[model samples]
Target chain A: MLTLAQAQTIMSAALAHAGTAGFKPLAIAILDSRGAQKLFAAQDGTSLKRGEIALGKAHGAVAMGLGSRALHKVALERPYFVDAATHAVGGSLVPVPGGVLIRDASGALLGAIGISGDTSDNDEAAAVAGIAAAGLVSDTGA
Target chain B: MLTLAQAQTIMSAALAHAGTAGFKPLAIAILDSRGAQKLFAAQDGTSLKRGEIALGKAHGAVAMGLGSRALHKVALERPYFVDAATHAVGGSLVPVPGGVLIRDASGALLGAIGISGDTSDNDEAAAVAGIAAAGLVSDTGA
Candidate 1:
């Protein structure tokens, strides 16, 4: 399980990156091993719904055992799976940026990170930075 | 039944734990026995869909008498039930994170925790921390 401290570091780094990049962001969230939310930050100039989107994207990553990007690939391959789960989950399940699945070096499931605001790609970059700054690894380039 | 205080503590603990560990996340939700929202946190950076997903997961946890993970698996097996529920709720049946069924010892229903951000696993972990921090029991393992 990634420690809360680590999650904070990630979020901080993400925030810093966002600020440096002059990106528009609302909130950022980090989860633990079991896909639970650990930390949440709603930055200034961020709307409330941005937080929800980050969470939803992160949720999708955790549920599917992959990042939102990977989920997007799966959605392309099998939209039905995504759609079915989407319906079951109500209005959540966005396969876009701002979400990444966290895992250990040994392939253990750690958790996920979500970001909102900016473009989908920017959100994803922030999430990546947050996780990386935390010293934990994200299952990416897979 | 988990009191509102407990629910709030659960969320706090979960957030603390997430930061300590290392994750990126979004929002979280808590539901009571009647499937009503008791506490909700729309963390920063969550996606637009997180609130709904969290609600759906929590709804599934309470309605199906299981955690959102279990509900997710079941929904995967039976997409129709998920489909039916979506229409039933005017499109509010997220079986994703931001939702987890909360239960008490002796297998009694208390409520649920729905989380967004990070991955579903991360969301689940956050919920676990929140519940544990609150000294409440979560039936995610059940």
Candidate 2:
């Protein structure tokens, strides 16, 4: 289980990295392996839809059991497949980068973190930083 | 359509009201009449699912063309009806007091606002105050 405290830590570190890196105000979401929300936050200046985008990234990762970086490649290669998956997931799947799976040192999946409000690569970097801060491994599906 | 500025004003005022009233930390969501998100924010320390609950409240109100207050009554009078409505809305409908319709002074619908993280009545109060702060009318369906 992904503890709430751990989820908060991931969010804080992710936001901190975003601030330090001069990224746009971000929205972040953490979801446990079961696709339940663990924590979510949207910075003051985030656009209206950023929150959903963030949730989608994380939810898609957990639902498909693949980090969104891999999903992105699949989306390019098989748009219809990803489209069907999105429908299967209740339309919460966002096939893109910036969604990273969280795993313990034992390589057990714990949860995922999704970030929006910057380029996909930069968002993924922040997710990586946050997971590292919690002493967890990040799988960007690369 | 609800502008981002208006939505933020509503959220800030609602949060301020909650703070002054000693309510718990809140999660707020605003959806335009078209059911598109306008804003969402969850205070630190909120429970994991509060964000989705907030969104559900607002989305349900927008989907049904009535305040969640009325939906609550419908739920009590006919549970199965509310259940069907919930499914029809993709499971976002949350029939409760905290979901309110936003309208102009002339009674034209503009959007909806929903709040979670406190008693349902208290949540409704905050949503009302937020809409008023934005110079909009609130229809609680009471």
Q: Candidate 2 falls in which docking quality class?
A: incorrect
The TM-score leader among the candidates is 2
**What tens digits encode model 1's per-residue C-alpha lDDT throughout B1-142?**
6688878788789888778878776667788998888988876655445566677677766776767666566566776776676566555555554466666666678898877667778878888888877666777733
Give all candidate RMSDs, comma-separated.
12.0, 5.2
What are the runs in model 2 whose C-alpha is more than 4 Å off?
A: A1-54, A62-67, A73-91, A100-142
Estimate the TM-score of every prediction. 0.53, 0.66
State candidate 2's TM-score.
0.66
lDDT (tens digit, per residue) of candidate 1 on A1-142: 7778777788899999898998985588777755678998898888758888888887777665567887777677655447745664544667876688776677676788888888988888887877778666776323
Candidate 2 lDDT score at position B54: 90
Task: Give stretches of model 1 more than 4 Å off.
Answer: A1-71, A74-81, A84-142, B96-98
Q: Distance from true position, residue A95, model 2, in Å?
A: 3.4
lDDT of 2 by residue, A1-142 (tens): 7775677678779878998999997878888877766666666666668888998999999988899999999999999999999998899988889999999999899999989889999999999999988888999988
lDDT score of residue B93 within candidate 1: 56
